[model samples]
Target: MEDRNMKNPLYLQTKMENIRRYSHDALFQFPKKERYLLCRQIEDCIERIIREVIRFQKRYYKKNTLQEIDIELEFLRGLIREAREESYISNGRLADWMGHVDEAGKILGGLLKFYQEKEAGRSGK
Candidate 1:
Protein backbone atom coordinates (compact mmCIF):
# COMPACT_ATOMS: atom_id res chain seq x y z
CA MET A 1 0.00 0.00 0.00
CA GLU A 2 1.12 3.55 -0.63
CA ASP A 3 2.22 5.68 2.30
CA ARG A 4 -0.68 7.82 3.39
CA ASN A 5 1.59 10.25 5.25
CA MET A 6 3.41 11.12 2.02
CA LYS A 7 0.14 12.18 0.39
CA ASN A 8 -0.27 14.90 3.03
CA PRO A 9 3.30 15.50 4.04
CA LEU A 10 2.76 18.53 6.18
CA TYR A 11 0.77 16.87 8.93
CA LEU A 12 1.20 19.79 11.23
CA GLN A 13 0.16 22.40 8.69
CA THR A 14 -3.46 22.54 9.84
CA LYS A 15 -2.43 22.67 13.47
CA MET A 16 -0.06 25.51 12.75
CA GLU A 17 -2.77 27.40 10.88
CA ASN A 18 -5.17 26.96 13.77
CA ILE A 19 -2.52 28.24 16.17
CA ARG A 20 -1.78 31.29 14.05
CA ARG A 21 -5.48 32.15 13.71
CA TYR A 22 -6.37 31.71 17.38
CA SER A 23 -3.25 33.49 18.58
CA HIS A 24 -4.16 36.53 16.52
CA ASP A 25 -7.77 36.53 17.68
CA ALA A 26 -6.93 35.91 21.31
CA LEU A 27 -4.06 38.39 21.36
CA PHE A 28 -6.23 41.06 19.83
CA GLN A 29 -8.43 40.79 22.87
CA PHE A 30 -5.48 41.51 25.18
CA PRO A 31 -5.02 44.87 26.85
CA LYS A 32 -3.09 47.55 25.01
CA LYS A 33 -0.18 47.14 27.43
CA GLU A 34 0.23 43.47 26.52
CA ARG A 35 -0.10 44.03 22.80
CA TYR A 36 3.57 44.93 22.43
CA LEU A 37 4.92 42.55 25.03
CA LEU A 38 3.16 39.24 25.48
CA CYS A 39 1.45 39.43 22.13
CA ARG A 40 4.68 39.87 20.22
CA GLN A 41 6.33 37.06 22.14
CA ILE A 42 3.47 34.70 21.41
CA GLU A 43 3.47 35.54 17.74
CA ASP A 44 7.22 35.10 17.52
CA CYS A 45 7.04 31.74 19.24
CA ILE A 46 4.36 30.52 16.87
CA GLU A 47 6.30 31.61 13.83
CA ARG A 48 9.49 30.04 15.12
CA ILE A 49 7.68 26.74 15.64
CA ILE A 50 6.40 26.84 12.07
CA ARG A 51 9.83 27.58 10.70
CA GLU A 52 11.45 24.88 12.80
CA VAL A 53 8.88 22.28 11.68
CA ILE A 54 9.57 23.04 8.04
CA ARG A 55 13.29 22.90 8.68
CA PHE A 56 12.83 19.59 10.45
CA GLN A 57 11.27 18.12 7.32
CA LYS A 58 13.96 19.42 4.97
CA ARG A 59 17.00 18.41 7.04
CA TYR A 60 18.30 14.87 7.05
CA TYR A 61 19.37 14.99 10.71
CA LYS A 62 16.10 16.07 12.27
CA LYS A 63 16.95 15.26 15.87
CA ASN A 64 18.33 18.68 16.69
CA THR A 65 15.67 20.52 14.80
CA LEU A 66 12.95 18.46 16.43
CA GLN A 67 14.35 19.33 19.83
CA GLU A 68 14.21 23.00 18.93
CA ILE A 69 10.63 22.62 17.74
CA ASP A 70 9.71 20.84 20.96
CA ILE A 71 11.20 23.63 23.04
CA GLU A 72 9.32 26.27 21.06
CA LEU A 73 6.10 24.32 21.40
CA GLU A 74 6.48 24.17 25.17
CA PHE A 75 7.31 27.87 25.26
CA LEU A 76 4.18 28.63 23.26
CA ARG A 77 2.13 26.58 25.67
CA GLY A 78 3.54 28.50 28.59
CA LEU A 79 2.71 31.80 26.93
CA ILE A 80 -0.87 30.69 26.40
CA ARG A 81 -1.17 29.64 30.03
CA GLU A 82 0.20 32.98 31.10
CA ALA A 83 -2.25 34.82 28.90
CA ARG A 84 -5.15 32.95 30.43
CA GLU A 85 -3.91 33.50 33.97
CA GLU A 86 -3.46 37.23 33.36
CA SER A 87 -7.04 37.46 32.12
CA TYR A 88 -5.79 38.39 28.66
CA ILE A 89 -7.78 35.49 27.27
CA SER A 90 -11.00 33.88 28.36
CA ASN A 91 -11.32 30.26 29.46
CA GLY A 92 -13.04 29.43 26.18
CA ARG A 93 -10.14 30.86 24.22
CA LEU A 94 -7.70 29.01 26.41
CA ALA A 95 -9.48 25.75 25.66
CA ASP A 96 -9.31 26.42 21.95
CA TRP A 97 -5.61 27.20 22.02
CA MET A 98 -4.89 24.21 24.22
CA GLY A 99 -6.67 21.89 21.81
CA HIS A 100 -4.52 23.01 18.90
CA VAL A 101 -1.35 22.83 20.98
CA ASP A 102 -2.23 19.35 22.21
CA GLU A 103 -2.87 18.11 18.71
CA ALA A 104 0.46 19.42 17.53
CA GLY A 105 2.19 17.95 20.52
CA LYS A 106 0.76 14.51 19.78
CA ILE A 107 1.94 14.64 16.18
CA LEU A 108 5.36 15.92 17.17
CA GLY A 109 5.72 13.26 19.80
CA GLY A 110 4.97 10.53 17.28
CA LEU A 111 7.47 11.95 14.81
CA LEU A 112 10.13 12.22 17.49
CA LYS A 113 9.64 8.61 18.48
CA PHE A 114 9.85 7.44 14.91
CA TYR A 115 13.10 9.28 14.36
CA GLN A 116 14.57 8.00 17.60
CA GLU A 117 13.78 4.42 16.69
CA LYS A 118 15.20 4.85 13.24
CA GLU A 119 18.41 6.28 14.59
CA ALA A 120 18.72 3.49 17.10
CA GLY A 121 18.25 0.84 14.47
CA ARG A 122 20.95 2.41 12.31
CA SER A 123 23.37 2.61 15.21
CA GLY A 124 22.72 -0.98 16.20
CA LYS A 125 23.51 -2.37 12.76
Candidate 2:
Protein backbone atom coordinates (compact mmCIF):
# COMPACT_ATOMS: atom_id res chain seq x y z
CA MET A 1 0.00 0.00 0.00
CA GLU A 2 1.23 3.47 -0.77
CA ASP A 3 1.62 6.10 1.91
CA ARG A 4 -1.05 8.78 1.72
CA ASN A 5 1.33 11.32 3.24
CA MET A 6 3.91 12.65 0.78
CA LYS A 7 5.50 9.85 -1.19
CA ASN A 8 3.62 10.99 -4.29
CA PRO A 9 5.25 13.82 -6.20
CA LEU A 10 1.92 14.89 -7.64
CA TYR A 11 0.64 16.08 -4.25
CA LEU A 12 -2.86 15.64 -5.67
CA GLN A 13 -4.40 14.81 -2.32
CA THR A 14 -3.39 18.17 -0.93
CA LYS A 15 -4.41 19.95 -4.11
CA MET A 16 -7.83 18.39 -4.09
CA GLU A 17 -8.22 19.26 -0.46
CA ASN A 18 -7.37 22.85 -1.28
CA ILE A 19 -9.93 22.83 -4.03
CA ARG A 20 -12.54 21.64 -1.59
CA ARG A 21 -11.54 24.21 0.97
CA TYR A 22 -11.42 27.05 -1.50
CA SER A 23 -14.77 26.16 -2.99
CA HIS A 24 -16.34 25.86 0.43
CA ASP A 25 -15.03 29.25 1.43
CA ALA A 26 -16.06 30.81 -1.85
CA LEU A 27 -19.55 29.43 -1.71
CA PHE A 28 -20.17 30.04 1.96
CA GLN A 29 -20.08 33.78 1.53
CA PHE A 30 -22.02 33.97 -1.71
CA PRO A 31 -25.38 35.71 -1.57
CA LYS A 32 -28.54 33.67 -1.38
CA LYS A 33 -29.50 34.66 -4.90
CA GLU A 34 -26.37 32.91 -6.16
CA ARG A 35 -26.85 29.85 -4.03
CA TYR A 36 -28.25 27.82 -6.93
CA LEU A 37 -26.12 29.26 -9.64
CA LEU A 38 -22.47 30.28 -9.25
CA CYS A 39 -22.21 28.71 -5.88
CA ARG A 40 -23.55 25.42 -7.12
CA GLN A 41 -21.55 25.49 -10.32
CA ILE A 42 -18.26 26.23 -8.59
CA GLU A 43 -18.96 23.53 -6.06
CA ASP A 44 -19.66 21.03 -8.81
CA CYS A 45 -16.56 21.99 -10.74
CA ILE A 46 -14.24 21.58 -7.79
CA GLU A 47 -15.89 18.33 -6.75
CA ARG A 48 -15.60 16.79 -10.20
CA ILE A 49 -11.95 17.71 -10.55
CA ILE A 50 -11.25 16.19 -7.17
CA ARG A 51 -12.91 12.99 -8.32
CA GLU A 52 -10.95 12.89 -11.59
CA VAL A 53 -7.65 13.58 -9.83
CA ILE A 54 -8.29 10.83 -7.32
CA ARG A 55 -9.16 8.41 -10.09
CA PHE A 56 -6.09 9.34 -12.09
CA GLN A 57 -3.79 8.87 -9.13
CA LYS A 58 -5.22 5.45 -8.32
CA ARG A 59 -5.69 4.09 -11.85
CA TYR A 60 -3.37 4.58 -14.75
CA TYR A 61 -5.13 3.55 -17.87
CA LYS A 62 -4.22 1.17 -20.68
CA LYS A 63 -6.41 3.37 -22.85
CA ASN A 64 -6.57 7.15 -22.48
CA THR A 65 -8.63 8.68 -19.70
CA LEU A 66 -7.63 12.16 -20.83
CA GLN A 67 -10.71 12.32 -23.00
CA GLU A 68 -12.76 11.52 -19.94
CA ILE A 69 -10.97 13.81 -17.53
CA ASP A 70 -10.75 16.56 -20.13
CA ILE A 71 -14.50 16.69 -20.31
CA GLU A 72 -14.79 17.46 -16.63
CA LEU A 73 -11.74 19.69 -16.59
CA GLU A 74 -13.19 21.74 -19.40
CA PHE A 75 -16.37 22.27 -17.47
CA LEU A 76 -14.33 23.32 -14.48
CA ARG A 77 -12.41 25.82 -16.59
CA GLY A 78 -15.62 27.21 -18.00
CA LEU A 79 -17.06 27.59 -14.54
CA ILE A 80 -13.99 29.47 -13.39
CA ARG A 81 -14.23 31.78 -16.37
CA GLU A 82 -17.90 32.27 -15.81
CA ALA A 83 -17.26 33.06 -12.19
CA ARG A 84 -14.83 35.76 -13.22
CA GLU A 85 -17.30 37.29 -15.64
CA GLU A 86 -20.06 37.15 -13.07
CA SER A 87 -17.85 39.00 -10.67
CA TYR A 88 -18.38 36.17 -8.29
CA ILE A 89 -14.64 36.03 -8.31
CA SER A 90 -12.93 39.37 -8.02
CA ASN A 91 -9.73 39.91 -9.99
CA GLY A 92 -7.53 39.47 -6.96
CA ARG A 93 -9.49 36.45 -5.79
CA LEU A 94 -9.42 34.83 -9.20
CA ALA A 95 -5.70 35.37 -9.42
CA ASP A 96 -5.11 33.72 -6.10
CA TRP A 97 -7.37 30.73 -6.69
CA MET A 98 -6.40 30.15 -10.29
CA GLY A 99 -2.77 30.38 -9.28
CA HIS A 100 -3.28 27.42 -7.01
CA VAL A 101 -5.14 25.61 -9.74
CA ASP A 102 -2.24 26.26 -12.09
CA GLU A 103 0.22 24.76 -9.65
CA ALA A 104 -2.06 21.80 -9.18
CA GLY A 105 -2.33 21.32 -12.92
CA LYS A 106 1.44 21.24 -13.26
CA ILE A 107 1.63 18.48 -10.70
CA LEU A 108 -1.25 16.76 -12.45
CA GLY A 109 0.62 16.92 -15.73
CA GLY A 110 3.28 14.66 -14.31
CA LEU A 111 0.62 12.12 -13.40
CA LEU A 112 -0.91 12.45 -16.84
CA LYS A 113 2.43 11.78 -18.49
CA PHE A 114 2.85 8.70 -16.38
CA TYR A 115 -0.47 7.35 -17.61
CA GLN A 116 0.28 8.18 -21.22
CA GLU A 117 3.61 6.39 -21.03
CA LYS A 118 2.04 3.39 -19.37
CA GLU A 119 -0.54 3.17 -22.14
CA ALA A 120 2.12 3.34 -24.84
CA GLY A 121 4.25 0.77 -23.07
CA ARG A 122 1.31 -1.62 -22.86
CA SER A 123 0.59 -1.24 -26.57
CA GLY A 124 4.23 -1.94 -27.45
CA LYS A 125 4.26 1.28 -29.40
Candidate 3:
Protein backbone atom coordinates (compact mmCIF):
# COMPACT_ATOMS: atom_id res chain seq x y z
CA MET A 1 0.00 0.00 0.00
CA GLU A 2 1.07 3.54 -0.66
CA ASP A 3 2.30 5.55 2.27
CA ARG A 4 -0.38 7.92 3.46
CA ASN A 5 2.28 10.10 5.06
CA MET A 6 3.97 10.57 1.70
CA LYS A 7 0.74 11.93 0.31
CA ASN A 8 0.60 14.69 2.87
CA PRO A 9 0.16 18.23 1.52
CA LEU A 10 3.09 20.55 0.80
CA TYR A 11 2.29 22.97 3.57
CA LEU A 12 5.31 21.93 5.64
CA GLN A 13 7.68 22.06 2.69
CA THR A 14 6.49 25.47 1.59
CA LYS A 15 6.70 26.87 5.10
CA MET A 16 10.20 25.48 5.59
CA GLU A 17 11.39 26.98 2.31
CA ASN A 18 9.99 30.40 3.14
CA ILE A 19 11.53 30.33 6.63
CA ARG A 20 14.95 29.25 5.33
CA ARG A 21 14.96 32.03 2.76
CA TYR A 22 13.88 34.64 5.27
CA SER A 23 16.46 33.53 7.82
CA HIS A 24 19.25 33.51 5.26
CA ASP A 25 18.57 37.07 4.20
CA ALA A 26 17.76 38.45 7.63
CA LEU A 27 20.48 36.74 9.65
CA PHE A 28 23.17 38.09 7.37
CA GLN A 29 22.28 41.61 8.48
CA PHE A 30 22.63 40.99 12.19
CA PRO A 31 25.54 42.47 14.14
CA LYS A 32 28.65 40.30 14.23
CA LYS A 33 28.13 39.46 17.90
CA GLU A 34 24.53 38.45 17.47
CA ARG A 35 25.20 36.65 14.23
CA TYR A 36 26.32 33.66 16.28
CA LEU A 37 23.92 34.12 19.19
CA LEU A 38 20.44 35.37 18.37
CA CYS A 39 20.79 34.60 14.68
CA ARG A 40 21.84 31.05 15.41
CA GLN A 41 18.95 30.59 17.81
CA ILE A 42 16.46 31.65 15.17
CA GLU A 43 17.96 29.34 12.60
CA ASP A 44 17.96 26.41 15.04
CA CYS A 45 14.35 27.01 15.93
CA ILE A 46 13.39 27.00 12.27
CA GLU A 47 15.12 23.68 11.77
CA ARG A 48 13.47 22.24 14.86
CA ILE A 49 10.06 23.33 13.61
CA ILE A 50 10.64 21.61 10.30
CA ARG A 51 11.86 18.45 12.00
CA GLU A 52 8.89 18.36 14.36
CA VAL A 53 6.43 18.72 11.51
CA ILE A 54 7.99 15.80 9.68
CA ARG A 55 7.86 13.69 12.83
CA PHE A 56 4.25 14.73 13.41
CA GLN A 57 3.30 13.46 9.97
CA LYS A 58 4.96 10.08 10.48
CA ARG A 59 3.89 9.31 14.04
CA TYR A 60 0.55 7.88 15.16
CA TYR A 61 0.60 9.83 18.42
CA LYS A 62 1.12 13.40 17.21
CA LYS A 63 0.03 15.62 20.03
CA ASN A 64 3.38 15.78 21.80
CA THR A 65 5.30 16.46 18.63
CA LEU A 66 2.80 19.09 17.58
CA GLN A 67 3.16 20.76 20.94
CA GLU A 68 6.91 20.87 20.46
CA ILE A 69 6.46 22.54 17.08
CA ASP A 70 4.19 25.12 18.63
CA ILE A 71 6.75 25.87 21.31
CA GLU A 72 9.50 26.27 18.74
CA LEU A 73 7.35 28.62 16.69
CA GLU A 74 6.70 30.76 19.74
CA PHE A 75 10.43 30.80 20.51
CA LEU A 76 11.04 32.06 17.00
CA ARG A 77 8.54 34.84 17.44
CA GLY A 78 10.30 35.99 20.58
CA LEU A 79 13.69 35.88 18.89
CA ILE A 80 12.38 37.89 15.96
CA ARG A 81 10.98 40.51 18.30
CA GLU A 82 14.30 40.70 20.08
CA ALA A 83 16.08 41.09 16.76
CA ARG A 84 13.88 44.06 15.91
CA GLU A 85 14.30 45.72 19.31
CA GLU A 86 18.07 45.30 19.17
CA SER A 87 18.27 46.90 15.72
CA TYR A 88 19.36 43.65 14.11
CA ILE A 89 16.47 43.79 11.71
CA SER A 90 14.53 46.71 10.28
CA ASN A 91 10.78 47.18 10.52
CA GLY A 92 10.29 45.88 6.99
CA ARG A 93 12.38 42.80 7.65
CA LEU A 94 10.56 42.23 10.93
CA ALA A 95 7.25 42.40 9.09
CA ASP A 96 8.47 39.93 6.50
CA TRP A 97 9.71 37.49 9.13
CA MET A 98 6.51 37.80 11.13
CA GLY A 99 4.41 37.16 8.03
CA HIS A 100 6.26 33.95 7.26
CA VAL A 101 6.20 32.82 10.88
CA ASP A 102 2.51 33.56 11.19
CA GLU A 103 1.74 31.57 8.05
CA ALA A 104 3.67 28.59 9.34
CA GLY A 105 1.95 28.81 12.70
CA LYS A 106 -1.49 28.85 11.07
CA ILE A 107 -0.72 25.81 8.99
CA LEU A 108 0.68 23.92 11.98
CA GLY A 109 -2.28 24.94 14.09
CA GLY A 110 -4.63 23.45 11.54
CA LEU A 111 -2.71 20.19 11.55
CA LEU A 112 -2.66 20.13 15.33
CA LYS A 113 -6.41 20.66 15.53
CA PHE A 114 -7.03 17.96 12.96
CA TYR A 115 -4.97 15.45 14.90
CA GLN A 116 -6.59 16.43 18.16
CA GLU A 117 -10.00 15.76 16.69
CA LYS A 118 -8.82 12.45 15.32
CA GLU A 119 -7.48 11.44 18.70
CA ALA A 120 -10.73 12.42 20.36
CA GLY A 121 -12.73 10.41 17.86
CA ARG A 122 -10.51 7.38 18.41
CA SER A 123 -11.08 7.60 22.15
CA GLY A 124 -14.81 8.00 21.75
CA LYS A 125 -15.26 4.74 19.90
Candidate 4:
Protein backbone atom coordinates (compact mmCIF):
# COMPACT_ATOMS: atom_id res chain seq x y z
CA MET A 1 0.00 0.00 0.00
CA GLU A 2 1.19 3.52 -0.70
CA ASP A 3 2.08 5.52 2.35
CA ARG A 4 -0.55 8.08 3.38
CA ASN A 5 1.96 10.90 3.07
CA MET A 6 2.92 9.87 -0.45
CA LYS A 7 -0.71 9.60 -1.52
CA ASN A 8 -1.56 13.04 -0.16
CA PRO A 9 1.17 15.58 -0.78
CA LEU A 10 -1.20 18.53 -0.25
CA TYR A 11 0.59 20.63 -2.88
CA LEU A 12 -2.52 21.19 -5.01
CA GLN A 13 -4.68 21.52 -1.94
CA THR A 14 -2.43 24.19 -0.51
CA LYS A 15 -2.37 26.10 -3.77
CA MET A 16 -6.13 25.99 -4.08
CA GLU A 17 -6.44 27.14 -0.49
CA ASN A 18 -4.22 30.10 -1.23
CA ILE A 19 -6.39 30.92 -4.24
CA ARG A 20 -9.49 30.72 -2.08
CA ARG A 21 -7.97 33.01 0.50
CA TYR A 22 -6.70 35.58 -1.97
CA SER A 23 -9.87 35.62 -4.02
CA HIS A 24 -12.05 35.99 -0.96
CA ASP A 25 -10.03 38.99 0.07
CA ALA A 26 -10.27 40.53 -3.38
CA LEU A 27 -13.98 39.88 -3.81
CA PHE A 28 -14.75 42.16 -0.90
CA GLN A 29 -13.43 45.01 -2.99
CA PHE A 30 -15.93 44.36 -5.75
CA PRO A 31 -19.12 46.43 -6.03
CA LYS A 32 -21.98 45.36 -3.80
CA LYS A 33 -24.10 44.30 -6.78
CA GLU A 34 -21.33 42.15 -8.20
CA ARG A 35 -21.21 40.17 -5.00
CA TYR A 36 -23.88 37.88 -6.44
CA LEU A 37 -22.87 38.10 -10.06
CA LEU A 38 -19.21 37.51 -11.02
CA CYS A 39 -18.02 37.12 -7.48
CA ARG A 40 -20.39 34.24 -6.81
CA GLN A 41 -19.28 32.40 -9.90
CA ILE A 42 -15.62 32.79 -8.94
CA GLU A 43 -16.29 31.49 -5.46
CA ASP A 44 -18.14 28.47 -6.83
CA CYS A 45 -15.37 27.71 -9.28
CA ILE A 46 -12.73 27.75 -6.58
CA GLU A 47 -14.78 25.52 -4.34
CA ARG A 48 -15.36 23.06 -7.16
CA ILE A 49 -11.68 22.99 -8.03
CA ILE A 50 -10.74 22.37 -4.43
CA ARG A 51 -13.29 19.56 -4.19
CA GLU A 52 -12.08 17.96 -7.41
CA VAL A 53 -8.48 18.18 -6.31
CA ILE A 54 -9.32 16.22 -3.18
CA ARG A 55 -11.24 13.68 -5.25
CA PHE A 56 -8.33 13.35 -7.67
CA GLN A 57 -5.95 12.56 -4.84
CA LYS A 58 -8.20 9.82 -3.43
CA ARG A 59 -9.27 8.06 -6.61
CA TYR A 60 -7.16 5.37 -8.22
CA TYR A 61 -8.41 6.42 -11.66
CA LYS A 62 -6.97 9.91 -11.74
CA LYS A 63 -6.85 10.94 -15.39
CA ASN A 64 -10.47 12.02 -15.73
CA THR A 65 -10.38 13.92 -12.47
CA LEU A 66 -7.15 15.56 -13.53
CA GLN A 67 -8.79 16.69 -16.74
CA GLU A 68 -11.71 18.06 -14.78
CA ILE A 69 -9.32 20.03 -12.61
CA ASP A 70 -7.60 21.36 -15.72
CA ILE A 71 -10.91 22.49 -17.14
CA GLU A 72 -11.97 24.10 -13.89
CA LEU A 73 -8.68 25.92 -13.65
CA GLU A 74 -9.17 27.34 -17.12
CA PHE A 75 -12.70 28.44 -16.28
CA LEU A 76 -11.42 30.13 -13.16
CA ARG A 77 -8.74 31.85 -15.22
CA GLY A 78 -11.33 33.15 -17.64
CA LEU A 79 -13.58 34.34 -14.86
CA ILE A 80 -10.72 36.24 -13.30
CA ARG A 81 -9.93 37.85 -16.62
CA GLU A 82 -13.55 38.80 -17.03
CA ALA A 83 -13.53 40.35 -13.60
CA ARG A 84 -10.58 42.51 -14.54
CA GLU A 85 -12.10 43.60 -17.85
CA GLU A 86 -15.29 44.48 -16.06
CA SER A 87 -13.27 46.59 -13.63
CA TYR A 88 -14.27 44.40 -10.73
CA ILE A 89 -10.60 43.86 -10.02
CA SER A 90 -7.46 45.82 -10.76
CA ASN A 91 -4.73 44.76 -13.18
CA GLY A 92 -2.33 44.17 -10.30
CA ARG A 93 -4.90 42.01 -8.53
CA LEU A 94 -5.56 40.09 -11.71
CA ALA A 95 -1.85 39.41 -12.12
CA ASP A 96 -1.56 38.18 -8.57
CA TRP A 97 -4.55 35.87 -8.97
CA MET A 98 -3.28 34.63 -12.31
CA GLY A 99 0.05 33.81 -10.72
CA HIS A 100 -1.64 31.51 -8.26
CA VAL A 101 -3.78 29.85 -10.96
CA ASP A 102 -0.77 29.37 -13.22
CA GLU A 103 1.24 27.78 -10.45
CA ALA A 104 -1.54 25.27 -9.78
CA GLY A 105 -1.85 24.61 -13.52
CA LYS A 106 1.88 23.79 -13.68
CA ILE A 107 1.59 21.38 -10.79
CA LEU A 108 -1.48 19.80 -12.37
CA GLY A 109 0.41 19.39 -15.63
CA GLY A 110 3.19 17.48 -13.90
CA LEU A 111 0.71 15.12 -12.28
CA LEU A 112 -1.12 14.60 -15.58
CA LYS A 113 2.13 13.66 -17.29
CA PHE A 114 3.07 11.25 -14.56
CA TYR A 115 -0.28 9.50 -14.69
CA GLN A 116 -0.35 9.35 -18.48
CA GLU A 117 3.05 7.71 -18.50
CA LYS A 118 2.00 5.23 -15.86
CA GLU A 119 -1.17 4.40 -17.78
CA ALA A 120 0.72 3.91 -21.01
CA GLY A 121 3.24 1.65 -19.32
CA ARG A 122 0.46 -0.51 -17.99
CA SER A 123 -1.05 -0.80 -21.45
CA GLY A 124 2.27 -1.72 -23.05
CA LYS A 125 3.02 -4.46 -20.54
Best by TM-score: 4
Per-candidate TM vs. native?
0.89, 0.75, 0.88, 0.91
lDDT per residue, candidate 4, 90-111, as tens digits? 8899999999899888888877
> Which ranges in model 2 have alpha carbons more than 4 Å from their true place?
1-10, 57-63
User: Per-residue lDDT of 31-59 in model 2, one digit per residue for the tens?
Assistant: 78988987887787777776765675566
- Sort by lDDT, best first: 4, 1, 3, 2
Q: All models: lDDT?
A: 0.83, 0.66, 0.81, 0.88
* Candidate 2: worst-modelled 10 consecutive residues by lDDT: 1-10
Query: In model 4, where is the ten-residue run with the lowest total lDDT?
Result: 1-10
Winning candidate number (lDDT): 4
lDDT of 3 by residue, 1-125 (tens): 12342234366656777898879988998889988889888888888888887787788777898789889999999999999999888899999889988877777777777777888999999
Candidate scoring better on TM-score of 2 and 3: 3
lDDT of 4 at 13: 89
Q: Any residue pairs clashing in model 1, and if so which?
A: none
Between prediction 1 and prediction 4, the one with superior lDDT is 4
